[model samples]
Target chain A: MKLSEILSLLEGTLVSEHADWDLEIGKVAAADLMSDVLAFADPESVLVTGLVNPQVVITADMADIVGIIFVRGKVPPPETVAVAREERIPLIITSYTMFEACGRLYQAGLKAVDLES
Target chain B: MSKVSQVTRLQELVYELEIAEVMTRDFLSVTPQMTMREFKEFLQEHRFSGAPVMEDGELVGIISIEDLIEALAAGELGCLVEAKMTRDPVVLKANDLVVRSVDYFGRFGYGRFPVVDDQGAIVGVLTKGDITRGLLRKLEVEYHQEEIRRARVNHIFDDVSSDHTSISLRYDVEARNFERGGRASRSIKRALKRFGLPRQIVRRAAIATYEAEMNVVIHADDPGGVITAEIQPDQIVIEAIDMGPGIPDIDLAMQRGFSTAPDWIREMGFGAGMGLKNIDRCADRMELLSPHGTRTTLRIVIYMDER
Candidate 1:
């Protein structure tokens, strides 16, 4: 799925630059725990989480997570925004809860990280 | 010295150094007949940590203070040096490159290794300190030589006039400075656009430049390095040179999702391991010169006339 489409569907505010909005994301992983995000997220996957911290962006970088969507309308701290800007990882803020965000992405055909793989 | 010259000097040191040039020739050795107690005293008296145990002019084993402590703890302090010494210990040949010893040191965590002759005789000992001292000395000599070469190159270039036919732009990239990361690529893009290059060509160059710049920021050690873009009538060449802990496995680093970036760096969203691949796809030709644990130079050439 293109990041722009996901952004519109969630009615999210893009905190990151628009340069990466056209990027194609193949999967989505939603989790509050950074460890779960690290273990389950793959490259090009858009990470959906309620956790608003610099570690979210860091986890995205380490796991090659393409974009991040902060659910529950959480406003990330300035440090987190700075890191996201620097890393060039796209960030989206959404009013949707974590469960709803995951469901929306999944229903839209974004696959979850398959443990079997 | 200017920063550019310093970088060039360090690069030459990595390329020009060899173990034979640096390995100590005069070194201490102990005989297998020496008792562990005597060996301990020998190490203490000389302030040495270890010595090769030579038997009949051949290196049979190596004993270190650690071995002595082990023997003491085991209540075997009276044991012969042969009994306590490590048999078939790792050794480095004189002709080996200094980089090989560096790899050995990193992998084995050994403080010292015996330097041996072709005849399997201990000629000297190679310690971590020896490598550091040797490299420093080599760096001084190479830095002077590099300055001379740079002066000659500059002299040649001084005659060339800056015209529509050719132009060069250089940008200094600071490692991990994400704030300034894409400035070089953006500037290059703007330059190419102003030069009236086709949109496709400009896009490719911009993408390649951005990836190369990010690679420098992401991977280069310490203060980071520079990228130079040379535009000719026929082609554009972008060279990114970094004082690096160079890519250990070029092939692996080139893979789609391979990245060594730590979690924190990743969280900021930069390391996708797609930098090199993207650079490759955007350039007509690309060359990487990476001497592991040293410097890395990446050259990307895009032919303007091809399209």
Candidate 2:
């Protein structure tokens, strides 16, 4: 699925200035814990989480996660947004809960990331 | 250290060296009460073309060689130095960057400027010669360091026909420093890419190193740990060693979802007990050594050919 399509389905607003709306995001890993995200996320996958700290951006950069979907109406602080902008990682914020956001994306043909893949 | 060309180094020095560092301290000053003849004698004795005029330890004016020449031409050698000196001369702060002085010199076309302290007292004088000399001295020191770094980098790339040719990289990880947690891993990844390694292999190595680094950042005691990567033609071996209150039960720590991390760490998205598992998944062979009071070392080996 294109990132734009996922954003609309999840009702998310891209907050970062540097973003690629047409990026292909076929895989996703949803976790509030960064360790889990780093462990299970496939490269180029979009991450869905409620954590709104700068570390989220750092973890996304390290895992090569292309974009982030912050759930539960959690907006990241300016420093976190700055990091996302510097890393050129798109940040999407949504009012939906983590479960709802993941479900919406999954229903929209995005596959869940697995360890074996 | 990264590679820096001479031009870039010079530019960096201009912004880095402060006016205080490049200015001439213990400078000679002429009191305003002295006559121009006395000032001429003082300048000739000290071999100075310019001097700052001070009264009660405060800068009042600047008298340069041109001012002196004008006084001589007008036959005003007996006039007081205050009568001939240029009053309320432009000055610079001691803490300002050398680049500011460069800008001032270009704009003012002055031979020198008096440097002042926070109290507006003259502390030193900065000249074009002083800036040039200071930059050259700093550049010399950095040039030697750069040469040593280039030598080390070249050693890594030399003699492929040798029986064993490998390069090792090491980085220190500080405990509880979540801000710099992944820096070591990122640098390792960059170095591997500089070697032109395969993308998949580099990704695996970077992921494995990053997991080990997170372990040290989230768990290790004060003074933290060390992450080292040794790369040969066939494989890469990464070692993460941490001085610690050692793990009491290695078996349980290795289990998935078994994390001793505090709530704060978990809230920050770490301490999921999946660090070791992630490293294990990325490596062809792995070893965990936690000797009772001393330290814990996680050794991970990944072959170059593996996908």
Candidate 3:
């Protein structure tokens, strides 16, 4: 699914300054732990996380996540937003809970990108 | 920045910067119902050469000083802006790359393009000057970051006079500093990246060093310790030494799922007993020495030629 479609499907608000609307995000990984993200998530997958911190952005950058969605209407602090903006990784906020958001994306044909091989 | 790299940097920035970052925001717009005389006065007051014409919060047309000049020449200053403004003006998307506007200006010969959001609401305006200023500003920021990085890591790669060149970097890691736990490894990773090492080597070294750093922070008994990376031409050897309550059985500690971390540590999403194994996987060779209660030294080596 395209990022723009996912945004609307989950009733998401793109809090970041810019996003690549046409960028295809075929996989999603939901994790609050930065270590799990680094260890298991594949590159180019969109991360659905409830944690809001600068470390989350750092982990996303290291793991090569294409974007981040903050579940449960969680708004990140300015420092976290600054890092994401500097790295050019899009950040979206959704009202749906983590489980609901994951289910919606999975139902929309996005595959899980965990359990690193 | 060097001249050659500066040129390449400029090329990179043009594609990286979006139109929203460069466009002029909170601009004044004129209503199409306003008379040409009123429009001329508004333009003079704001000193704007052109402005988007709006109706009910929507962009309807564009009127410029040239239109005012024609109105004056034709003795039609009393006419409404709708009669003389250009309808269906060309626009640029706020999320589009600035490079696209460069092409747009060259092809359309317009002095400025009104930038809009996905809903087609006029958000800002972009001119040639905006793009130039934006690129220069971004270039300056990038240059400063590059300079700082060079200054920090410059000593590691230069000033070697031995027949066998191996430069070592040491960073202190503080125990229980959860916020700063990854500092040492991050620095090592950045220094290796600046050295222009292969991507896989840099990644392996970074990951292994990070796991080691975390171990010190989580389990070390003393206040702090030191982690060092000795970089040789063929391999990089990383050693993380900590004054800690040493692991009693190295064999059991090496197990993938065995962890001695307390509940608080596990709550922080670490201490799955994977650190040692992760380091082992990334390093070409690994060594661990933990004398019952004295200290723990974890050494990891990665070769340049190895997979």
Candidate 4:
């Protein structure tokens, strides 16, 4: 799924300048632990979470995540936003809670990696 | 004013003032006897700000979680304590004032200090945590000392903003020899994440940045050097240089047909006649400067649109 489609589907607000919303996103990992994401998640996935910190972006970049959806209408700090901008990470704001966001995206045709793998 | 008996001039109660007062006696310290891997495990077990090295009942040195963090940033392989430990561990005598300890720590940035007896035996240890408490306990000279302390940090990344740029704070240099590769690349990735660089851009930056580091390490031999990165709101620039082993042919090296990389580099999934090409593809601008013999300089740039 493309990030733009997800945003349009969820009616997500464009908090920052939107670029490359058409970037292809494969799987999604929802977590707050940066180390876990860096160590476990595959690159080219969308990251969904509410944890807002500079380190979160670092982990996401290291893991090669494609897009970051700030769930629950949470706004990230300036430092976090700064990192996103510098790294060219697309930051989207959505009112959907983490569970709902994940499910909606999944049902919307975004496939996640199997847990058994 | 001197003759008033109600205002008695009495001495304040102060402890014998040994670093031992804060040392964790139960906590095991890494001695020379342990392997480097064990020392890594030791760091993982305890969330210690730092630890003192003890050998046969005597203090030789000290290591901290920060040391390991810095070492891991460097990527040193093998017995690390031998390679990573700071030599001539600074000591705080039992009678030394807490002020002295603070000054020493503030200057040397020693995460922890060992309190020792006259017999050279470590009786206790002092950490930054202990020192922080010591500062708040005894009202410090707030104005001048505080300014002096913050000044030394020099905060190489101070002007950085997560508001528009990647804020990074990792270095992979030969500081203590614990580790010294992939640090610049790792930090760039972190900065990209914090700055919210888009996924494709972030990956391009990491690959481009890392290839530059790898080039310096493998080609820049015998000459000590560094790979420096700068993240402005508009772009990220990575420059790697070494004073040894200069490239003979820039044109051929840039070509996809020519490569001097060893078999090991290919085995590691690199040196497929692709380094320069990959970097060229990933970076906005690529520049190389070398005069033959040893030293080589590589520069890479990644731009972020203001939209």
User: For this target, which candidate reaches the highest lDDT against the unseen true structure?
Assistant: 2
Order of the predicted models by DockQ, top scorer first: 2, 3, 4, 1
Task: Provide fnat values for all models in the order shown.
Answer: 0.00, 0.56, 0.10, 0.10
Error of 2 at B38 (Å): 63
lDDT string, candidate 3, B1-307, tens digits: 4789878878988889999999999788999899999998998898888999999999999988889999999999999999999999999999999889999999998888899999999999998888989988887887788788766455544655668888789999899887777777767877788777787788778778888888898999868789999988789999999987788899999988789988777666678788787788778999999987579999999998858
Residue-level lDDT tens digits of model 1 in B152-269:
4334335565555468999999998876676687678777776667766876787678778878988899899899999886799999999988988899988878888777656755
lDDT, model 2: 0.88
Per-residue CA lDDT of model 4 for A5-91, tens digit only, reads 989877787655545977887788887644335434667887887866554565566557767888999987787787678767778
Q: List each candidate's DockQ score.
A: 0.05, 0.43, 0.20, 0.07
TM-score of chain B of each: 0.46, 0.63, 0.61, 0.42
Model 1 error, position A10 (Å): 3.5
lDDT digits (tens) for residues A1-117 of candidate 3: 899999998999998886999999988889876667766677789999998776677667666688999999999888778878977899999999999999999899999986744
List the candidate 1 regions with Cα displacement exceeding 4 Å.
A1-9, A13-92, A97-117, B1-164, B305-307
Query: How many clashing residue pairs, candidate 2?
Result: 1
Better of 1 and 2 by DockQ: 2
CAPRI tier of model 3: incorrect
The runs of at least 3 residues in candidate 2 whose Cα sits more than 4 Å from the true structure, single-residue gaps closed, are A115-117, B1-162
Q: What is the interface RMSD of candidate 2, in Å?
A: 1.5
Give one digit per residue, the lDDT tens place, for model 2 in A63-103. Answer: 88999999998989998898888779999999999888988
Candidate 4 Cα RMSD (Å): 23.4
Clashing pairs in 1: A57-B267, A57-B268, A58-B267, A59-B267, A61-B266, A62-B266
